[model samples]
Target: MTSSRSDTRSKIVDAAERLLREQGPTAVTTRAVAEGAGVQAPTIYRLFGDKDGLLDAVAEHVMATYVSAKAEIVRAASADDVDPVEDLRAGWRAQIEFGTANPTLFVLLSDPERARRSPAARTGMDVLRSRVHRVALAGRLRVGEERAVELIHAAGTGAVLTLLSTPPSDRDPGLADDLFDAVLRRILTDTAPFAEDGPLASAVALRAVTPALDMLSDAERQLLTEWLDRAISAASPVTR
Candidate 1:
């Protein structure tokens, strides 16, 4: 978009988000947003296609902030030699805080259909996948990398939603921490496992580095990945 169009889009999104924050989703009508943004209603249609499209942009704006923070956390791991598990925890806490603090925006971003199509939502998952890969490389993840990512994602989402559902005064403040610990216990080893402990941990660690195994032929890489996947999933519980 040109500078003018980009500025116009920003103004409209800002107005819509302010309405969403102050008065909930219903308050973000095109007419209201146009008036707040000092633009014609046709401008909103031109820029965003429709209100649903405008809301998608709103979700993207909120999720882009979230996903950028998450990406920085992932980038810091390699740059600073941070512990991957601790990095995961930091990201988890950030996610929880974001969700609980912006309940309306969180609801918009977390809607499954919107998430499926949202670039920012996918970027957030990519950050988590990277985080999980770091843990697997450290041999601290006792499950497959994909499985670990799913577990963490599910647990974190559930924790946020559960917290949001309760009245703040009645909510258990420790619940998020406790749930993270529980998930860690389920998906991690006390220490990096020895070869004899089980195939699961070893498989996960190897899986994390498989793409960088330059010596392997295409067929060999494919075969090795298939074997590791089978071994990892053999005992893994299915996501419901």
Candidate 2:
């Protein structure tokens, strides 16, 4: 049977996502996405407005995938009861794997246009900053003040972007986790003393970020949460 218009629109998005993975965001034009989805270029425009809109859609798709994979990775690994340092290492490794597997989408996250146009990108930064603050609260990491969380995110994102931009040959992919682990370790070590002491301290620290999460409207949070779930469902895992 012929697909419905909604189905067709979804196919266009799927096509955009694929082309982005195969040829980077630059290849994902209305013409290209339409052709890939076997629809006319006008259909793509009708569905998404313009090239930037398409890119925004694709970015939405990619961010969703990252969040889902993150949830899975954390859920699976949470059973390990590892030390704070080891927990950080595992998280770093999962992030590197996710990035390497979706290099094109990862590259798109680094795009200035994405930062400019996508609410998901902004929400992601909020979530990450919250996580950092949580670590500080839990005593797993040391962050001296509220502002320190933003400073840590700046440095961490810098490390992540640098690692993403560098090819494996230049700096062995195996070392990405170790390199980030070291960066996080140094940051956390300095803040560990300020952390609250308790058996559930780390968990409590993570909750500290709830205030940040609460900043978004309920509708916005739900929309983002659903989008993230769909993105993960759409992403096919690949070996690097």
Candidate 3:
């Protein structure tokens, strides 16, 4: 009985996913999905609650597969010793492509309330956080890991939305790349700075690994962390 119920749910979700992908969100009505999945409309209501509930299930299903593929790519790149900064760029480009290609899904996930509550969106953010952490370990990130992730995410989403608003033929091919570079400039150092007065980048990098350094006593580590935070704050760029 459990297996049969699960199968019914999968059929409905699969049908909804196809309708969303092929004809956009408006085509994913409960009646249409029930017809596509060869089930009665009440079956969809019993399984998914409503149209919004069904759409959420479809988003979760599709994005789970997409995020899993991206996770594998990141894992492979890390195992191969790809440059952390380059890997980050690759991830950024992949996200842009995904958003542009599936504008409907992208817009659905873009809803602030939905995005904040979404498991799939949180998984994607976790992936971004890991990539940013890698860059910080490499001494390339200039800002704190959380700040860098937030900046990159906002910039990438904005870039995709801007491009989507433009006609395909009239869209600037370099817009996304240019925006990415601009973000990189703000949040990452081209090279690790070793100077005494300009040790902010190094301080930020060291802070990421401080807990792993067993050589320092807890008190000593605390002192170092305080000092590093002051340095990082002093050197951080002021945003309007």
User: Which scores better on TM-score, 1 or 2?
Assistant: 1
Give the true-structure RMSD of model 1.
2.2
lDDT of 3 by residue, 1-240 (tens): 999999999999999989998998889988899899999999998988899999888888878888988888888987898898899999999999999998888888899988988898999999998889888888876677778999999999999999899999999999999999999888877563454323667878998898788999999988888887777776776331
The ten-residue window of minimal lDDT in model 2 covers 231-240
Clash-forming residue pairs, model 1: none
Error of 3 at 165 (Å): 1.0
Give the lowest summed-lDDT range of ten residues in model 3.
Answer: 190-199
Question: Which digits, one per residue and each the tens of the lDDT, describe model 1 over residues 47-135?
Answer: 99999999889889988987997788689787999998899999999999999988887878778998899999999999999998888
> RMSD of model 3, in Å?
2.2
Using TM-score, rank the candidates from best to worst: 1, 3, 2
The clash tally of candidate 2 reads 1
Off by over 4 Å in 3: 192-198, 215-227, 238-240
lDDT of 2 by residue, 1-240 (tens): 246977987788899999988887778877788889999998888888998788778778778766656555444544554454554455555556666677766667767777766666666565455445445555554323233444444444565667667776785554555556555644454334443332223333443443467878978766655653343223212100
lDDT of each: 0.86, 0.60, 0.86
TM-score each candidate.
0.92, 0.63, 0.91
Q: Clashes per prediction?
A: 0, 1, 0
